[model samples]
Target: MIAMTALAGPPADTLWATSLRRWNALCWVLFAMMAVGLATMDGPAGSRYTALALLGSVVLCYAVLDRFPDNPAIRPHVYLSVLAVALGGLAYLRSNYAALFMVTLPHYWMFGRTPRASMGFLGLATVGTVAGSVLRQDGWTVEFFSETVVSTLIVVAVGVLIGLWAHSVVAQSTERARLIVELEQTQAQLSEAHQRQGAADERERLAREIHDTLAQGFASIIVLAEAARAGLDSDTARSAQQLRSIESTARENLAEARELVGSAHRPGQTAAGSVARTLRRTLNRFTEDTGLTVDAELTDLVCDQQTRIALLRCTQESLANVRKHARASTVGVVLTRQAHGVELEITDDGTGFVVEESTGFGLDGMRKRLAELGGRLTVTSSVGDGTRVLALIPMAFEAPGEGEAER
Candidate 1:
């Protein structure tokens, strides 16, 4: 029953609604054409007889058309019955030419929306034609029987072809619609994946900035303060006072770094006043006391608080490495926005070493910090060649609940 229903196509209710409208229009047109043909035809049996017969067939066809909208199988049987009556009436009138129209009636009737039902109608029509011709002739000669059989076969074949073509068209249309729906679903999934990937990237960048800047600076202040406390009894009282001042300043900077880091972790925190400006102030203070040429080129690039902190830390780490290892002339810091990300270049004409052979914690820590933020750090240096450290962080990375901000 399920297979049978599937073969019929769609639900019976929908098919009924669609087929009824079409059949109603077709029936009316068929009735009008038949009525005109009957009126004009002059017959020995009389025009009244032909008119009554065509009118009766028209009435029957209309009744069937109206009734079988909910049942497609019944429609073809109704059409076949009407054609049989018309063919029989024409044969009685000795109008063989008009009776030939009966052969083509099944062709149209059998090729309605349902192809399986139409094929059944085609078989019925073929049998009825052959049987009617034999019964009317009284004596079936080979010549007459062969002609009727051949004509019936031709009509059936044509109806079958029409039914197959209609089925093909409907199948193609259904498949195209299904494919379009699938394509739309796939596009939606891809868009969602891209959004998620962008968010993950941003979170990592924030993590890297925090580790490099605030964390490393606090460690340095702790070490320096302990040294000053231990050496206060010696003649290094001036150095102890200087170290005490450095400790106080480091504590102040630590408070600022904590606030910035908190804002980066928390969503919806306004980043208007907390950006490169704060970092620049800290760097300026460090340069003033140390007399280090901190050639800083910081931009007004707007980023999340966490990302800002990460970038600041990255800068601090690079500078710390410069102060510790790169003992040379001028040091240059360049921070610039790229097409898809940001780049920070720290160059110094210091005594360079083999990057592969060195197992320093500072460089390794820097690399690890950048990786968390979906960024990369590359160190380019050789013996006596000016050391250049380049860090690249993609703008695509965003923390959860945070969106990309313009630079």
Candidate 2:
């Protein structure tokens, strides 16, 4: 397998650049042989001139290509090999440049070529090398030609053998590149999964810590404070009622905190009744705790369990926000089942503040919860005006038979 990290190039160019470099290096070896032939030729003057002219043209093409290695136009062109083959064919007509031709064989199989091209080049190179050798010898004699052909066959066969080996190397490099990309993608997925698992673990850990420490302490303080506030009937006790009210408020906050921590890992809904009953119970509890009146018009809501839980949690969040921010006397809530879906609206005659681009996490969390079940929430409010929150949750209609079958 090819190890790209051990090679040299820009990161994106590694695969093709490395293969092209190897191809160019092999082509240069053929250039060296042609140079040697031009330097020392013992053939007849006419043969020598023809050989030099053909070989020189090949050399000039090589130089042009060498000057522009980064040129995309020249990168994968097989015209270089085609020109060399033409030169070799003409040189065989006069002399023999068959050995120089064999050195050019490696460039064809080096990289980014189809097997069919490789096969065709094998046949072309083999034929050119053998024919060049036969033409170099003056032989109408069968024995001389037979010996020349046998030797040429051995040389060309060896070239094919080595070319096959280099082809295997290119194949390995290609596969190694594919596996490297697969490994990177798999590692990324594993990293994301590990992060998600770690976050979940930390959430569970934080929940446990709150339940064990803050929750227990708050529960104890709330019981003691409740008893203390109830026993106060004297005016002296009533004078401290404001302080006691603060204590009870802290306890109620602790109650809300406990509910959150306790249900941190509860997979599904906590509501046990129809949407109307759950809303009425939540409103009643809000009234008893904060001493504010809430008028609700509710009806049966047909939704999945998760949607039901989402509505209940959003209600709790809205009421909790009102208790903390709204210093008003009355609130209104309405839930109705329409033909398309279910809608819930909560409005309050509170000292509402200006709505800014950034809302607190309370409102954002409610929006996200409803959005998950194909639901949407819209909040409308302004300074000193009332706040209204409307939620629309979509559910697909199921046939009566399908519901009965599931049951």
Which candidate number maximizes lDDT? 2
Query: For residues 97-216, what per-residue lDDT tens digits would candidate 2 score against the true structure?
Result: 555555565545543265567657666766765666566665446875566566667766776676666666666877888889999999999999999998986775555435433543
What are the runs in model 2 whose C-alpha is more than 4 Å off? 1-142, 153-158, 161-169, 176-272, 397-407
- Lowest lDDT sum, 10 consecutive residues, model 1, at 1-10
Per-candidate total of colliding backbone pairs: 9, 0
TM-score of 2: 0.50
Computed on alpha carbons, the lDDT of every model, listed in order, comes to: 0.62, 0.64
For residues 1-407, could you state the per-residue lDDT of candidate 1 as single tens digits? 11121222343488775665566556556645765565566655575566566556756675676566577566555665566555545444443533454434434433344666666655654565566566667777988756766766775676566557656756776786688789888888888888888787566555544555555666657646665667777749755665865777688667757865676567666363334575677567556434567677766566765457556666677677666677866777776777778777888888887989978666776777768679889999998987888988887434343222323
Could you tell me every candidate's TM-score relative to the true structure? 0.46, 0.50
Indicate which candidate wins on TM-score. Answer: 2
Residue 33 of model 1: what lDDT?
71
- Cα displacement (angstroms), candidate 1, residue 227, comes to 4.2
